[model samples]
Target chain A: MFNFNFSGEFVAFFVFAVMIISGAVLMVSFAKVVHMVVSLAAVFIGVAGMFVLLEAEFLAFVQVLIYAGAVSILMIFGIMMTKHQEADAEQAKPLHETLTAIGALALFGILFYAIRQSDFPEPEQALAQGTDNTMEIGKLLFTQYVIPFELVSVLLTVAFIGAIVLAKKEAE
Target chain B: MLSSYLTMAAILFCIGLYGALVKRNAVIILLSIELMLNAVNLNLVAFSKYGVVPSLTGQMFTLFSIAVAAAEAAVGIAILIALFRARGTVNADEYDEMRR
Candidate 1:
């Protein structure tokens, strides 16, 4: 389980792993709401870096754009619009918090055990590593997955409109 | 390699789950949900690259999920704002309209 190669990919993955873990930990521990959002942005960027390392360059950029850039900004706006404490008053829900932590850790333990136990067979055929991942993705989006693509776009439109409607001021 | 990525994703998912369940702020809870979604995306992308049937399907799935996650975030924030407007507080523990 401890074996590792000194490949470039290995090193990159290691760095991103550290970055993401720390950022996520900080997000959970930070008392300030804005600080949590900032740390979450770091986690988002680290995930994008992992995408790049996995050769999904287009996905990497999209991750950066949507999660790190747009979503982070949106969350910050949400915080700004609401009345937030400078330091979130730590509620005395130790039992609830402890139970939740145990549940989450149990889930992780199960997942880790399953991952370690399973032996994934090598692919008989190598995936087509297209020179231009974006172009290839575009082709696939326009062809094989066109219907779902269109549906997702429609979902986005409806969701944004719904958000506007739900948040609009009531003129009583 | 695949195991490593999967393990990393698991850790993220667990952390997100904990945060979502424990965080008091509704916005932070929403952010934690996003974190959970992101962990799933990482797993999908990792499998796309290293799974037995290496294909673009997983990446395509990731793209769709990302779009959905964006939609979720927008709608979630809007609802949160509405809730805050009605109640004048952002604490998750205080949203007990249904309970009462």
Candidate 2:
């Protein structure tokens, strides 16, 4: 049974849940491209708050810095490069849209059923957090996850270079 | 508590899926994909603190995924711009050259 405790965490969780869901729904409903991105930014910020509620302070800041800041600006730049037209300009595909909606709904129903039926064992312990989480993460990144971290760096470099190459205009 | 987080992620994932599949704008499709990725990150972070074995590994995974997502968004925007320049349009439906 789900007990609704009037704790601060619960209140915060509900607030973020409402923020995220409404923002996502607005993003879906918005016709204008910029409005959609703005709403998605709200959703990203809400997710960052959720990260804070979960006590992943570093990830919360990372989420804010990356998703809310970098990604939103990147998306706006993308919108700038592309034609700004109404979303459903070309003849409406009601059948296609309805099918997609039904499929997504079906997937959600399955996931919800699975989540509700599973009996998860109670957590044996909370994550051992040091006073400085960012430092802790930095240590883990250098020590435990060094190889992957390095590889990701390489990936980022390659991806950005490729992106620049791809986006650059051709010589006429 | 865990179930509630899972449910929230599932809802966002579904909405993102709907948008990705239905949207005509390629940029919006990419944004939807990011939305879905965020939902997954939320799940990972949620499980990190609340799972049967709590650890920082989940958070580590989130960090890696977030980095990858940033790179993905960059490349995606680049491709969208290139496609727009090549075809003079950003509509996903219009980019069906293979079907022709």
The model with the greatest lDDT is 1
Encode model 2's per-residue lDDT on B57-81: one tens digit a residue: 9999999999999999999999999
Docking class of 2: high
Q: What local lDDT score does residue B48 receive in model 2, on the 0 to 100 scale?
A: 92
Listed for each candidate, the true contacts retained, as a fraction, are 0.88, 0.86
Alpha-carbon shift of residue A171 in model 1 (angstroms): 1.5
DockQ of 2: 0.85
Cα shift from native, residue A77, model 2 (Å): 0.7
| Least well predicted 10-residue stretch by lDDT in candidate 1 chain A | A121-130
For candidate 1, what is the lDDT? 0.94
Off by over 4 Å in 1: none
In the range A1-172, model 1's lDDT, one tens digit per residue, is 5358989999999999999999999999998999999999999999999999888999999999999999999999999999988799996689998999999999999998899888888777877877898998999999999999999999999999999999999889
In angstroms and one decimal each, the interface RMSD of every candidate reads 1.0, 1.0
